[model samples]
Target: MRDSLRFYLGDELREIRDVDPTLTVLDWLRLSERRLGTKEGCAEGDCGACTVVVGRLTEDSQGGKSVRYEAVNACIRFLATLDGCQLLTVEHLKGPDGALHPVQRALVEHHGSQCGFCTPGFVMSLFALYLNEDRPDERRIDDALAGNLCRCTGYAPIVQAARAMHDLGDRTADRFNDRAATAARLKALADEEILSVGSGDRRFLAPATSAQLAELLLGHPDATIVAGSTDVGLWVTKFQRVLSIVLYTGRVTELRRVADTGDALEIGAGATYSEAAPAIAALYPDFGELIRRIGAEQVRNMGTIGGNIANGSPIGDTPPALIAAGAALRLRRGDATRTLPLEEFFLAYGKQDRRPDEFVEAVILPKPAPGARFRAYKIAKRFDQDISAVCGAFRLSLDESGNVAGIRIAFGGMAGVPKRAAGAEAALIGQPWSEASVHAAMAALKADFTPLSDWRASAGYRAEVAANLLLRFHVETTDPATETRLVGDRRLAHA
Candidate 1:
């Protein structure tokens, strides 16, 4: 067991001890390290002004370790979570001779900065993109920079900078390009020991394995388990809630696996949305599209599917989609484990069916049959980086006669929980897949949920949008080429 938190900040090895468990990465960077490159915009995960790239050792198919760089919101990310990883800030981008990196040079050349407060974040985000992809299209560029919001200089120049970064020079041949050494350092840091930092009520523990996590959870039942810290980070930044015990699940190896077991897709609870996206998109395209709109690229990189379900938020985007797909939850408590239907896990607002010692291990999504039609839609105020007002997911299976043999409907933001529309499903099952049947199901939706009004939308608007989303699902499934979405298809007519 180790009490000290060890990670690499730029090229320097840092061994930290006796620090507050809830200390955010942004604070540690700016205050402790005295680096002023990473700025704080919203203090929450919304604004990308605090964006920084993290490099973690990832094992490939051949059992070789390589560094995987991802941009994350430093303002919300806890400092304790940086154990066994490499932290890179905007200051680490310049060459040894003080020459600007390709990402920074491109931004300067394209006039991507105005007031320059948000420029560091934009550089880090684009640097991550530049490292990962050889060339990013319009969609990829938009997705990469979606988390960052610049009030002074519009996104047009930033978009141009992202497009022009690759053309500057050889992006891969840089100082941090020595993946083998970085991976070796990371591997050496992964000692497979339980990290217990801090004492008493204020504590942070990161277990290296699932068994260790299970034992720790059993010991400290009240400890808050955090996988990605996407939502939990807000409790400290926005709500200013002082967490007593924080048990981080990022180091638990088994919890990060994503596999297809022939029958169903088994996504480990710790798998980030970015890690699980390809497999999910392969199974259902529309569901993947909804994930793309979850909270921009930075959020997707840090947010986990299990955390999304375990948090039990009424507006969580994945729950409705997973419920519609007939997903199952695998939970663990010490040596004991159990499986339950995904919809049954959520009981009410801010309440889940999970015991304090029990943690969600995996989510099993059953593959739909050949005759199944699946669709998911999210109605939010803005197109990106916004919470959902109404999220609807549908799956319908037709028999030989084209009648609804079996159907499942789930919705979020319409009730206290991410619930299945039992009334709506009952109305559609055994009925023909036609316009009249869909209308009947839409009417039955009112009986299933009485949505509450909030600033994002009114109750009446929620009701109307929920019903129309169902109708839209019907229209989409009935006609293959309906062109229902307004913004999905993007093509550059002329530069």
Candidate 2:
């Protein structure tokens, strides 16, 4: 299928008529156009070498022109995904009069660049921020450029440039409001084409619909599904996997939705960590912070929940919380769909139970129980943007008498895969809520799974911590030993 592509890189549309649609937008920008401002330090999304902004139409009160926008990594981002989306790159920073955009000008004035290789990526990310916000806070600045890295100079100046950019851009916020006609025209142009990128014998297919996407997948079941490419990109960039037929999900609007039915929360399969973070955090506060720390903002903006789950890394942070929360995954094929327990979706190392035609659709989460004690924790070497040594989730229910009714315990990076501690839960189930009970539950962890020693941690360290986590959970949920408990419910009293 041939699709039309429209992107405003300055004042012109680089409409390539009827090209293969699966090409990386970065490949098109760097190779086809020779813009070169966008770097490719890492072909994966993490390095921010190919950061770009997509100015999609957004609605506001005035509604003259919608100016809402988001920033994404261009390296792994497919060119077909830009069909109807406004493509903003570092090259667009110059005004018609040759004046630099606030971000670029500030970088110039503040000497934010030294070696200059990383400047364009950072500038584009900040420019995306400039187009979106009139006033950006420190946290906002941090969030906007989290995916970018500068090796030449200290990050302080770049951050200062962000502050100055916000101040300068705030003065003309109303003037920059996109004209309604312009936005309407752009939105009208969305999804106008399909382009595939081919290298050697490998082809990446990115169709705009499930039927079209499924046909590509069904025909090529061996094809790798590329959603955000946060991990698989690592396979290509670092481990050097020979990837053919990367089926990108960005054009699948059905996968970007988020819904709440009061009883349950649902997130589309392609919902990036950036897109679904706020809702996921609102439902599970403890887990929200973890999501924030998952890579940087750009990675979060590009990485999808389904991609993280599908990757099946033992260290993936989302699965432990998801498994503990009793979520379900929606999968779709040509015309058929199925839902399965989220925990059951994972089978082994880097493997899932999905059929050849099936791909993840959405993740459904039920409402938390009333007065239920819930918590999720991540133990990492560094506080931010680091992989976890261990991540855990706990949920507890109490009976009318306040005794433990049920519990779910899950952990990542402790075993071969993120798994529920069945033996631990069995020890706590129907047992009195006492120190002895906590000890019993902790001991059960020894029987659950024997952990392995890796570069991040040792087997003994994992086993000991896994068991101790249960006792710690007990102490955290119940009253402290130092504090006297006046429990009218005798069941909760000390033995």
Please write out the lDDT profile of model 1 over residues 26-68, one tens digit for every residue: 9999999888999999998988999999999776767677899
For candidate 1, list the clashing residue pairs, or say none.
none
Q: Candidate 1: deviation at residue 196, Å?
A: 1.1
- What lDDT score belongs to each candidate, Candidate 1 first? 0.90, 0.75
TM-score of candidate 2 against the unseen true structure: 0.86
- Candidate 1 residue runs with Cα over 4 Å from true position: 483-495
Please give each candidate's TM-score. 0.97, 0.86
C-alpha lDDT (0 to 100) for residue 156 of candidate 1? 98
